[model samples]
Target: MVEVAWPVIHATQVEQVIAVFLSREHPHALRITPSQGDKGLDVIVEQADSTYHNFQVKYFATNLNSSQKRQIKKSLASAISLHNDKDSDFDLSLWILTMPWNPTTQQLGWFRQIQTDLACPFSCEWRGLDYVNGLASKYPQVVDYHLGNDKSRLEQRIKDLENFQRLRALAGMPSADSTLVPQDLLTPLAEVVQAINRDDPHYQFSVEAGPYAPPAVSRPGLIASTTIGETQVGPFVTFHVYARYRHATDDRPLPLTIHLNEAALTEMDRAAWQDAIRFGSPVTLAPGSFTLDIDLPGGLGVTNGEGTLRLFASDLQAPQPGPVRWVIVGPASWSVIAEIEVQNGPATRGVAGGIEFEGIDSTGIMTTRTRATPNPNGTFNLNVTISLAPEQELIGLPVAQALQILRFIDAYKPGNRLAFGPRWEPIVRDSAQLIQIDAGSATALISFLTDLNLVSNECGAPASVPNWRELTRQEFLGVRNAARVLAGSTARLEVHESYIAELAKSDIEMLPKGEPVAVTMPTQFELKVAEQKFVLPFTEISFSRITIESSDQTSPDPDRGFIVFRPMEGCEITQSMPYGAEGDDSLE
Candidate 1:
């Protein structure tokens, strides 16, 4: 058996081996050397579609340290910069190749974070020892050429494992004992769990909702109040820190330090405070004892309030003694008020505005309105109001439920066009029209064209008259043109600003209008040529009586203007007219 250390392999040799393997795997791919200052890309494979797959080879004996990791990050950043500068027309996939060892879990997490921060257009992958081993297993010749030996030992090791498994089965014994379990598999799981549960700072601290004052009714004084409390696990020194609160609508920070007092730190062990400064690292104290709470006088505004508290702790003692713990507290709250209103309703006895629909049991409805009002706008207005409870005032509205409600409301919007098929229906032309749209928290009021003295079969009116009476022929023609234009068009509807002001739930005060409502009425004339039947697009279609006689006979007088059909290009007029008349004038 021959042994070859992976760390001894040169970077250039690794690149060549990878190139060979890639070429074998993808016969159509073309390999090319990158030019000088080619970012982090050492070897590039170009495809027929102009897509580029880049590879960077690094051979190392041991795991990367913090500095080495930073170096790799910097190199990747430079490569990203170069890629952006070139603005290449093709998509790119970058592969970072390292041999002998894979990156640690922490290093992989860091790499993922960096990838997200950069937001590069290209895809990235980390090809470590496992990837190299995979390639070697597939192409033994390539591995032997580079490493001076085949994968005989690796093959033997696999056989040994197979033999061990068979022996264990024959003996009727368990396949794995504690001693047989590889340290690599167990160590990662143990370390990750410990790191998440203990070392992670987020798990060490927590913030909770506290006491609050009721919201005022006045416009300027309508301040929702709340308290913010933080709890830290284990014993640590406490310090009074400056606090600030930001309003949802404004960027200016409001001073919350006035509310901070010693009483807020009552949860912290008074006994621990005496020895906290004297104690060194790993000092033990009673669990669930360290806490700090502060009351917010003004609470969050009618919208939202985000508060941040900063503090410092001195724990380093022996070699370098200074403040070692730096804590930043960000506690947020919102004063959310959700209201929904409907415009008009039928009058009923004992109902103030309209009627109230309440849930029957104690487990009442979480959403939906119980009260409805009849507005003067000839519509029913249903109102549902929601305010943040004292406990939830600090956190504002629950994110999960709020998203669900918003999604439901979004799904309730009107679709584009209402189809009435080919049949014409009677539309109330002179009545007061009410357009009610459910737009989440906002009320939409839409105005449409009305009172047009258009031609209609609903009112028992003739299709066409000898003399235009109440409605002129010109007016009828104009209405037809307007209807055609309005068929597929869209219109915007206005939302009442007062509804938004009252709710304070959303900043959007308008529901954007949807596609125009089209009304199609039947025309007077229908034409049939051969097998195809055509409905005239125009509504003002009319027909008149006409007389046609032979050349030897005298023709009778024409009664009225005759309607003619003109065939445009691409239209096939298969049948000939009775008199052999052609071009421009075809009677239907």
Candidate 2:
């Protein structure tokens, strides 16, 4: 075999190439166009004497087999009539069958037999592979016009791939070269993200998945795949994070850690706060970008939140890759409550594309930071934190999602310190089914319960569940001036700003924290708030001996919760103090 630069070509395109070749040969070739009636010849050439020559072009990528030889004889048989229009029958001048494939000895013999059997008056010829090759050499420009050479084809393919990627990207679709992800691998990734949620200190976490488009895409690649292990070209994903972190005035990447294996959610995992995707370790993160990877069954992915992350490197294979990404979206909030977003939806617009949770608190200034890493399961881990102002309410979120988030924070676990305000307080207590709300206004609590459909206008709890038990009017008000007072502990009462210009709880008295109070007591001492009768349970008898305390310098006793005392006769102070004393046990 001699080496030659002959360009490889397609059989279907052979006629087109031949058309150019023949048209070039006879500048005035009378091409039989579709607009005209079907002709026995693909094209015709005029001789000087006005006689015509016929050329029938056929493309056969394979050798002339028996069936093809028979078709050829049939095709040639039609030439018995006039070879030119208006020419008498049997007046065939010349007929040529042009085909791309060379004929074998048997095929040539068959062709000779067909000619002998037809016994036509004019000559018969075959413009097979050898003739076509000689024609190509003689008219190289025509070949180039029809089919480009090797280098041109490669360059064109590159351009095609780039153009396709550009088009898809402009349309917000995944890149043509995008690495699709494995669906089963996504389970672990989703689990890892959940682990980030369980382990990270983000007030709100979410994921913004990049497109998981398969190899089923434009020009250079197949638009749809069926063969096994031929998918997951790329997986582009993003994880979100949000927290309240006070960064120092310097340029430094955030700190984070990620664990891939699914195991117990303990230690910082908050033995009580873990899920199926729980667990992680610590790692450092550069401000704007970071690295991510894990030993996944397939390949890798990319994306970030409130910031950016780039994707490259890794494997992506598994039948067909679904658009699944586990992202730790950072929840956002401007007020007391953060929005807890629902997760996981359709592939096109997963996360439902409803609301984005990027953990940004745009209250006054923007202080969003991020941290991300990868798991061994080809999933990712990301965390974020923002700057928060002092005095703002902690944990303002939807009740249900709030319940879920609360279960994972440091405050919910032992051997941990929960960050609040400027200090990290040691969280010595924990509970799963209970939450403490210290809103002094019963009306506010009632409104909240109403919003959640957990309570009625009359403060009646829903259903027979003891957790939602009913509350009495007086008890609905946070225990003011009450304490966890032991027998020796001193007690104090609080006066709140009047709920109305002239209304107060009558028969006000000392009570235990969360203790139900009586609405009326005939013998209770009363300090009138514009004449709304008020009473204290233990104060009527000690009215004269009771102390009226303020922020005075005389003394400050912290343990002031035991019994309640009332004001002196004719001495009225309408202030409803959740505290009238500065004590550690002050009713708050």
Candidate 3:
């Protein structure tokens, strides 16, 4: 059962390889032969230069494991045992022959197992292709580089036929006797293997023609519109409050709530008015319009024409001002409507304005009258007059400075009621000291502390009038002198000959540590300027230790994400350290 054709082919190939090797060693004899059944040796070759080699040819188109190698070692051991009786001296080099290959981990592990279990001397495994190439390089004359060129062609043809048969089975097709594959079939398979070799399964036609796809975005459209009407009669100028709301395309309604002023409510019947005009009333208007109206009462019940009935349109009224904010939303058809803004007028004198101030503690002041008037409750009326120069008007400073002045007064005095009066009011009405100004300029501001009185000195007396004793002058002044001085000095005035217009803008409030306080502006005045309409969704994403450095670990680029360190969150970044990759000792 020799089936000896393959051995002839292998011997011829070995002959050229041995010849090539002989040329490297001069004056050497070389012989290559097949296995002799008596000795059970696969191949034995002798060199003329007192050298010899033992050969083993492995013809496998697949991988080898540890167990198979162990079997080969067992056969070698048996052959050696049979030859133990003969006395001979033979030097040997073991040569292995196979295709161009390197052993995988499993195959290497098998070779290691053979060494460990069988106690073999050689621990290294050499590739057959490398040995052949090395031999050809060593003995160039006998190498005959093209000796295996025709056999390689035949082997390649056989491999091609086999691969086509395997693929035909995979593709649910029938294999034929034809050796050449169809161009269409071979082209596709070649492309597939190329893609696989490139490690890009995504490029495969089987994966690209999948059924899944990303969802499409949808645009919003106008959904619905409605109208509302109200008509009534009464004697007084009645007040009506209507809530105008809109239902979004998604069916979510945002109701509007507006509080009526005292003037508008004073003349109307509170009981009857609240009954008809309830809270959360929907606003309905003509089609394609966002308008609504509620009829008001006339002088007595009027059913006739031209009766002067108060007509109140809900759209005519502006939203109540808050925190001095302003905004404009539009559909691009009409002029921009200011959705938020403060009403600027002198009417805010008695009423509250956008600016507000609350007292922190009590304060005091003194007058030059040197007299105390008695009241109905027998409590003395301590009137103080803190004077300013004729040109020193106090109505020009920013209101915030005025507030700080009030706080300063409170720190000086513990419990004193205060008010800021006009310049024409008594500067020395009751018992007060005159604060003579060394600097006569109108814009000259009084310092918080001075030589005469420790103005803002927590442990010292007043700077304007220092002689007064037994009077806790800190709680003496009724008018807010500090606020007045602040309002006068730091403030800018828009003078119109008769009346002064406040033009000075207030500075942002400073926290204790000189940081700007995050105060919420009034809903009426905040502005959102964006390149395009973008909704800032309600999301809280926390960023922890953005400046993390791990030279020993792998990390992606820090600048490649949500940019955790935003400039606005008060992240006062001066410099950033460079990031190093894992195992990168180049920086060293």
Q: Write the per-residue lDDT of candidate 1 for residues 1-588, one digit (tens) a residue.
A: 222366667866765666655554544344444464656665566656766776655555477877766766776776677677756543566555445467889867987888888776677777777776676666565566455673455664565456555545444544574234434335434443333222111111112222432221212211222333343432222211111111111112233222223443445434334323322111222323333343322222222223332221221112212211111111221111121122222222221334433221111112222334557896654444322222222122322333333333333333311111111332222321121343443111000112111222222222221112334444434434433333432212121111100111121122112322111112322322222222323222211211111122222433222212322223321111122222222112
| TM agreement with the true structure for every prediction | 0.25, 0.24, 0.19
Query: For this target, which candidate reaches the highest lDDT against the unseen true structure?
Result: 2
**All models, RMSD in angstroms:** 32.0, 28.4, 43.2
What is the lDDT of every predicted structure here? Answer: 0.36, 0.37, 0.29
**lDDT for predicted candidate 1 compared with the true structure:** 0.36
Scored by TM-score, the top model is: 1
Q: Score candidate 3 by lDDT.
A: 0.29
lDDT of 3 by residue, 348-434 (tens): 111111111111111111111111344567554433323222322223333233333333322222122222222233222232222
Ranking by lDDT: 2, 1, 3
RMSD of 1: 32.0
Ranking by TM-score: 1, 2, 3
Q: What lDDT is reached at residue 205 by model 1? A: 19
Worst 10 residues of 1 by lDDT: 442-451
Model 1 ranges with Cα > 4 A deviation: 1-4, 30-35, 44-52, 66-71, 93-98, 150-588
